[model samples]
Target: MGSVFCEGLTHAAMYARFRPQVPASLVNYILSFLQEKCKGPMNNAIDVGCGSGQSTRVLSSHFKNVVGFDISEAQVAEANKLEKLANVSYKVNRAEKLPCETQSVQLVNAGQACHWFDLSKFFIEADRVLVPGGVIALYGYQFPMPIWENKTEKLTKLFTDLYLDSLHGYIKKESLDVYYSNYRNLRFRIPFEDYVQIRNETLYAEHQATVADFVGYISSWSSFQNFQTQHGQEAAYDILNTFETKFMNELGVNTSSADTELTLRTNYFLQLGRKPTTTTKRGNSPVEKQTNLTH
Candidate 1:
């Protein structure tokens, strides 16, 4: 991922604090392939471009062991502050260059951060590290939106213009724009596409969010961070502050601490594939266990 996305300690902290997690149902969709593989060391999975471990922790519940990597040291540092799970570990590393031994992993997944990666390199690394028939899942949720009256809709448009206006030249072709524009054709590389079983879907998660939560979430965006950098922080935040005022006025709600616990719905674009295999041995099998394991 880019520096603006997860580089500095401050931005990294905000991202960790506000980013919603990969929904459990979506995680189940990825793990459903290996539902039988529930037990043992053969169920190793990797989460690439894992910023601050929100996605990593969810992956650990299914896989016997999970390794999460990000390019930012500060993001990894922030991720480590989350409650430690027995099966999860995080590190600072690149998505294109994985450290796992060849065919040593049962699954690989990335959440909300693949667009920043070099897809060709990431696919090659995934191919090298995955065991035959191992699964690779990449999924992302769009920005959460509060479902309110007409003012909520109009206010969103107003704030969105400000957000994009601030990001004039900083936009890149390979960033989240690609995901939002045409996720169906999001690029992928060899062996997996040709030989792997691949598919895509949308997943959902529901939350009741406060106005403060919504504002904090918006502040966590990479584009917003870029806006803060290009314009001064005060000028950037002024957009959000203005929106908060509009929100309260239009909705007839109190601005007590800028917290409005309103219902927000979140959904994800999920792209999943499995590596090809010659012989299939279900990992959950009571008797068949692979001797070679890497962590």
Candidate 2:
């Protein structure tokens, strides 16, 4: 698992360059939940696995002090270059052995990167670093929207098959459920108080995008990167071209510059759990048992 995670870090630098549009409504919902549930002011928060710091930047607005940490030095450097906030900083650090002192943080968050963690160790570290009544929130969701045209569907399936074949043990789907279940079983786990579904009410949005934009976004996936690297870039390009041709012919539109509307069905689990007050010391804290979340 450690080796897989390290390999993932190698490509983390590209994450922000292929930025996806996240809904502001979703961000607002999460921040509002934290403000209500957390004990202290949302002044100090830590973002774990903060690749490219997209989510971390959003967190900065709600928290007085926000630090985003990732294992990849390259990723941290890239995040540093893109944006600067008065109260937010980015660092390279391991999630299992966080650099923060005990009981110093008000909130600890992981966005789309919790699946790579050693959960038992991570929860312990989270518990250690959070003050009593400090809230730990974990949220993630699937990429691209659930609604798919036939051409897009074929391309997505082909990409998934290629990636699974390449990485024999990686669990691509169900990542959010896996992390949520892990947190639910922890001794200090707090019940989720709110749930948010950020979806477009209409099939189309006001802003338009071309088919090429859709293709580029899909190609930016980590799985697609592995597929291109292992199977050859020519093959990946061929598959993408075929899908794009199909869309153009059927829809009478070019994807790259078209004004087509796209909607995303993003589901977020906004959970807030308080740190236990009387738990054993950091070193002596009872280890949480591990259960297999992948099937």
Best by TM-score: 1
Highest lDDT among the candidates is held by which one?
Answer: 1
lDDT of 1 by residue, 18-126 (tens): 7886788888787776544333455788888888899888877666788889999989888888747988889999998999998788888888877888666677677
Tens-place lDDT per residue, model 2, 1-295, is 1121123333554477444544566566556655564545666889999988887888777778999999988889888987768888999999999999878888888876676786657876787787665666665554444234545565455534534553333334444344345334343243222213222222211223445555565565655666667787666566666655655555555443235545434444444455544545544444232212211
lDDT of 2 at 94: 91
lDDT of 1 at 115: 80
Candidate 1 runs further than 4 Å off: 1-9, 34-42, 149-152, 166-168, 189-200, 279-295
Query: Candidate 1, which ten residues in sequence have the lowest lDDT sum?
Result: 286-295
Output the TM-score of candidate 2: 0.71
lDDT for 248 (candidate 1): 61
**Candidate 2 backbone clash number:** 7
> Scored by CA lDDT, what does every candidate get?
0.69, 0.60
Each candidate: how many clashes?
4, 7
